[model samples]
Target: MGMMDTLDEWHSIYIKAGIALPGALLSARFRDEGSDEQKMGLLLATALACLLACAAAQNNNPTENLALRGRATQSSTYYNYVFGYLASAINAIDGNMDSNFYHGSCSFTNNDMSPWWRVDLLKSHKISQIVVTNRGDCCGNLIDGAQILVGDSLENNGNNNPSCSEINYLPNGGTQTFECNGMAGRYVNIIIPGKETYLTLCEVQVFGVPVSKKPPCS
Candidate 1:
C-alpha cells in the first residue's frame, strides 16, 4: 500500500521476468534516512522518471521496430473492409509473421494487376532497413517478386520510387530484412512488377531515423 511496497511488487515481477532492479530504484539509503511522506513521494517520482528515461533510451536503440507508427495504404483491399486485409496491415507493426487465418489480416490483397502496398512515414527519414514477412499458411508464394521501394514521389502511385530490395521468393512463413543504407524517403512501397496477383504480406517493418536538421532520434 506504500511507495516502497509498490516498488517491491514491481521488483518481484521484474526479477521473475529476469530483469534486475537498478541501484537507483533500490533506494534503501533514502528509505533508511526517513519515512517522510514527501521524501517517499519524491523517491517514487524519481524512480518513475528514471524508468521513463530508460524507455526513451530503448526507443533510440537501433533494434527497436519503427514501423508501428506509420500510415499504410494498399492498391486494393480484398473488400473495402476497414480492418479487413487492407493496405493498413503491412504497417500494423504487430511483427506477426504467421500464416494462420486467426492471425486476422496478417496480409492479403484485392485481386488486381500490379497490386501495391505502401507506408507513409509522414516525414522524410534516413531509412536503414526494411523487413518483409511471408504468410505461414498455404499460398505463401504470393509475395514472390515483390519490390521494396522508397522515395518522396507520388508519381505513378509511388510505383516509380527507387527500389531498395526486390523479394525473389520468401519461403512460407518466412521473413527477410533488407538494409537500405540510409536511403532518404517519406514513402516506402512494395510491389510485384508486371503481375495481376495477390500481394499477401504477413507484416512489413521499416526502421529509420527521421530526416531533420537537429539530432533525428534525440
Candidate 2:
C-alpha cells in the first residue's frame, strides 16, 4: 500500500482503539491498572497523532501566491501620456490579474535593452512554481523569450541569478504557470534578454514555503 493508505489504516486503528481520548484522561485512565498492550497502544496512538500533525504542518500548498507579501521593482516604468498612468512594477503584485493594460492593472517597462522586473520576497524560499499573466489589450508577444530567474544575489539587478524557466510563448490575456521545482531564493526576477523591448506583465505569482520552514536536507 501507498504511504497515505498506510497512514489511513493507522488512523482507523487509532480511532477504533479509543486511543484518541484527551492526553491527560488517557494517562490517568491507564496510569497503573491497564494491561501492557493497552499502554503500548496508547503510546503508539500518540506517536501517530503527532506524526500526522507534523505532516499537515509541513504540507506546502503550491497555489499560495507568496509574491503578494513581497516588494517589486522594474528597470523602468512606462508612462501613458493620454491616460496619465504610470505602469509601475507594484501593479503586478497587487493581486489584480486583469490582463488589459488600459485597465491600469498591468506593469510595463520602458523600451530598453534587457529590461528586468523583480520581486523581493524579503527572505529565502523554496520556490516550486511561478505564474505569469500576459497583457490582453496589446503587445502580448513581447513577453515571449523572457527568463524567469531566482536567487538571493542582487548582482546585475538579479538578472544574473540562476534561471528557473524561459517563456516560449504566452497568449494574450492568458496566464501560464512555470514550475521551478523548489529553487531556493529570496528574489524572483523576470527579464527579456538580447533585445530592446518593452516588458509587460499583468500579474506575477510565486508559490513556495520559507526556507526556514522546509525540512533540512537529508
The numbered model that scores best in lDDT is 2
Candidate number of the best TM-score: 2
The reply for model 1, stretches above 4 Å from the true place, is 1-61, 80-92, 213-218
The list of candidate 2 runs beyond 4 A from truth reads: 1-42, 53-60, 214-218
Tens digits of per-residue lDDT for model 1, 105-210: 5656777899888888888888888988777777778888889999999898899989998998888888888989888899998998899998877788888877
Provide the overall lDDT of each model, using Cα atoms, as 2-decimal numbers. Answer: 0.72, 0.84
- What are the TM-scores, per candidate, against the unseen true structure? 0.65, 0.79
Worst 10 residues of 1 by lDDT: 83-92
Q: Locate the minimum summed-lDDT window of 10 residues in model 2.
A: 16-25
Tens digit of per-residue lDDT, candidate 2, span 1-218: 44334445555644533335345434343345577776667667656665554454455455568999999999999999999999999999999999999999999999999999999999999998999999998888999999999999999999889999999999999999899988999999999998999999999999998887733111
| TM-score between candidate 1 and the true structure | 0.65
RMSD of each: 8.1, 7.4
Model 2: colliding residue pairs: none
